[model samples]
Target: MAQQLGGRARSLQEGPGEYRLDNGQHILIGAYTESLGLMRKLGVNLEQSLLRQPLRLRYPDHEGLSLPPGPPLLSFVRGILSYKTWHLSARLQLLARATVWLLQGFRCKPELSVAQLCAGLPSIVRQELMDPLCVAALNTPSSQASAEVFLRVLHDALFSGRGSADLLLPRRDLSELLAEPAQQWLRVRGTQIFLGTRVHTLKQAADAWHLEISGAPQGETQCFDQVVLACTSLQAAKLAEPWAPAWAQAAQALHFEPIVTVYLRAPGSALPAAMVALNEGPDAPAQFAFDLGALGHAPGLFAFVISGASDWVAQGLKETGAATLQQALQAFNWRCSPEVYRVLAEKRATFACTPGLQRPGIQVARGLWAAGDYIAGPYPATLEGAVRAGKNAALACLQV
Candidate 1:
């Protein structure tokens, strides 16, 4: 049971308008095997629902790092060498760092932040690639993001398989991509999905696990044999506190970072590519922008996403929106004047994936498991992380 239909990944309508805005722009790399595999299993047409392309940090005016089609490692090497934007020494510095990471099998000192790991690289390389990639993947700045987690993401994307480095951008609404289809898939299999339902408390009993529910017409209690808590870390912590105080504390101890998505509307405006990486600065609140028109969505709609946006959140949405508009204006030549359409911020969008941060494990109590992106795992807080955690919990519950 979930509090919301999509649980942080859904589309919402603003001002009763026909157009819907997503909480933020989400990008899935080809390395997200469990998530992609599950979507395929749910009968989601991968080709129709997603736009796949070789991962490249393409800027507005010039090409940045564009990986060619070939073996993963070779493509990475070639891509770095071919990009003339960086001095050859800067490129070699990146390659040297990567070689060291690979030799170490992508493992690092647990306490090292991503910034420190890439500190020796050229400033241009850090600014153009590592910093943005670190924030996008971990939702935490490189200075605080975990080096271990970042390396793992790199390993999976660049060294795992052929298409693992490809970027998979959503071509449909967020709900249509996964949430709604997943709900439908479960309903046909005789699973009862209780939307707008809340499990207030969980109590252990001899025969089964008794759940103290809220606003149930029949009663306030429900029974289950094996249960998996798939709600947010806060909700799961409350229910699991009595059973597993240590686990609950760990879940609660996690710090979070916010993400802001500023949607801008420019009539008949089109971007050079489907996605463009912007130069984030003191005034620029966005790191990446998406041409929704190019992504098979509405025409002339653009999403400017600011990951790790604590500073922007403090500045207020009004200021953030205005700054984002100015940034957009400076970056591209618009068909007409672009206006701030909407600014959406997820305060607790993702946990601050800092170095040495601890997360709660899946097992909470006897025959009861916990699942969410916040669960302790190799990966950071992502759809792939959440899906894999849920899948693992399901498999574990099946064993019992």
Candidate 2:
């Protein structure tokens, strides 16, 4: 309503030359019902745009946990038990810990970090599964990530129902999935579509909300009965400072985590799977790699994603790209040496999903509302969270 994108992530980006690559390399799970429903409503072809696959954490050696197709609970148990690489004790220990979490309704203390909650688990399970999972789901390390949110993600992905954990790899660019279709849908509904517009200021008048936007005719102030601040948190904070200082401060107080995506172009190469989980160490900079070739988007292209990349960000992008190139060389079998095609870093990719994190709520004032993935919610800062927040905010605005 405000801009072309209501609550889309900044991960989708354009690269130099003719190749249109995703800068942040975002992945959506089957549990993201809100986003998926929105896409379907926009008349986008989900089957053609996404490559759905069962949940698998396979490595180059094909040694990792994988869920089979069946009843959700049975599939999860079978997957965990059949993972032969983990010791029998390690597997049993994981099951026991998971049972405890499930019995407790997948809820935990808000102050407990993921590492603290899984402290007694076997080291192998932590290294191979929990650590990467925490980073991927929360975009934060286990020691700093929130246990409550981690459990929520696990519940939805592993235990909610069948296909809930399936990874929806984008076969097309994000523009096709969200922005383009959404814009067309809005335009079809008689909504005025304005590109390259900025809301310079916002103020509450006696009877209506006033917005000083760039695209307004003759520099007029646009008046509306209700206003939804669907822009970035920083911009929302600045606009709401005059109306709601406390909410503005809360929005400004939230910290952020960065994500780095390194795209590699290898001539005539492919990975064993569409997506593979990698081990991250002091020298290794990537946690997961996606074979764009396998996803049917590109022929010999790959994307290495480094979530919770605070340390990697400090070392500089060139060093990070070089280290990732070396890591890829050792981790996978390539037809030719992979060269770094482009390196993209999102400094404020997500709000730090840490323990006891306080986020701003959607309600800013009586006649105004806010929406973003960073708004207070059960889910982490993700595409699903953004969609749900925007829908709720719009519904609330309509009711008022």
TM-score of each: 0.98, 0.96
Query: Any runs in candidate 1 off by more than 4 Å, and if so which?
Result: 1-4, 15-17
lDDT of each residue in 78-192, candidate 2, tens digit only:
9999999999999999999999998999999999999998999999999988998899999999999999999988888876577888888898877778877887888889987
Kindly list the per-residue Cα lDDT of model 1 for residues 1-400, writing each as its tens digit.
5444787888887666557877788899999999999899988999999999988898988888989988878999999999999999999999999999999999999999999999879999999999999999999999999999999999999877898999999999888888888989999999877776789899998858999987676589989999999989988998899989999999889889999999999979998899999999999999999999999887889999999999999999999999999999999999999999888999999999999988889998889899999998989999999999999999999988
Best by TM-score: 1
Clashing pairs in 1: none
- Candidate 2's C-alpha runs over 4 A off are 1-17, 215-220
Worst 10 residues of 1 by lDDT: 13-22
Give the TM-score comparing model 2 with the true structure, all chains together.
0.96
RMSD score of candidate 1 (Å): 1.2
Backbone clash count, each prediction separately = 0, 0
> Candidate 1 versus the native: TM-score?
0.98
* Residue 148, model 2: Cα distance from true site in angstroms: 0.7
